[model samples]
Target: MHIEQLKQKIVAALEDLKAQDLTILDVKAATSVTDYMIIASGTSSRQVMALARNVQSTAKELDVELLGMEGLDAGEWVLVDLGDILVHLMQPQIRELYDLEKLWGEFANPINHQA
Candidate 1:
């Protein structure tokens, strides 16, 4: 799938679970690791895990490889690696602490989305 289509699917998956603070950062020019960084917040650990799982399932349907998943046990911050897209599902508190959006925001234009 194209990057834009993949990003849409990811946003849909996150919205399916009612994820908050959804932000899509375009890091293509800033980094070679991934084209886009999707950051969202789930209310709790279970919700965080659920959000990640939803992304995984959706990605599978799209034929996107699930590179890896991290922080599932702790559920504080789960990172989903899909070849060109890196998803970060975190609790509101954790999101605030790390402020990943700002970190990556500095490097390039970060697209602030409201799904």
Candidate 2:
């Protein structure tokens, strides 16, 4: 699937499930690991995990396979790798420390978005 398409799908799933501070970063020009990075926060651990799982399942329905999932135990943050779309579902604390938005803020050049 296209990176842009996957990014939109993940964003929609998170928004429908009420994830907050939705941020999508296009890293295709920056890194080879992935084409995009989706960072969002959920109020609690359960919510964060749920958002990750929902995203995973939805992507599957669309045939977007995950490379792997991490941080399902304490669930502070769940990283879902969708080849071109890397999702970061985090609680406030985890999100703060990682500061993904800050890291990508300077590089998030607005591009065509379907979502």
What TM-score, to 2 decimals, does candidate 2 have?
A: 0.88
Over 1-115, each residue of candidate 2 has an lDDT whose tens digit, in order, gives 7766667777889988999888778777777888778888999999998998899898888997778999977789999988888889999998999898788768664344343
lDDT of 1 by residue, 1-115 (tens): 8889999989999999999889888889998999999999999999999999999999999888999999999889999999799999999999999999778777867786764
TM per candidate comes to 0.96, 0.88
Error of 2 at 112 (Å): 9.2
Q: Which residue ranges in model 1 land beyond 4 Å of their true spot? A: none
Alpha-carbon lDDT, every model: 0.92, 0.83
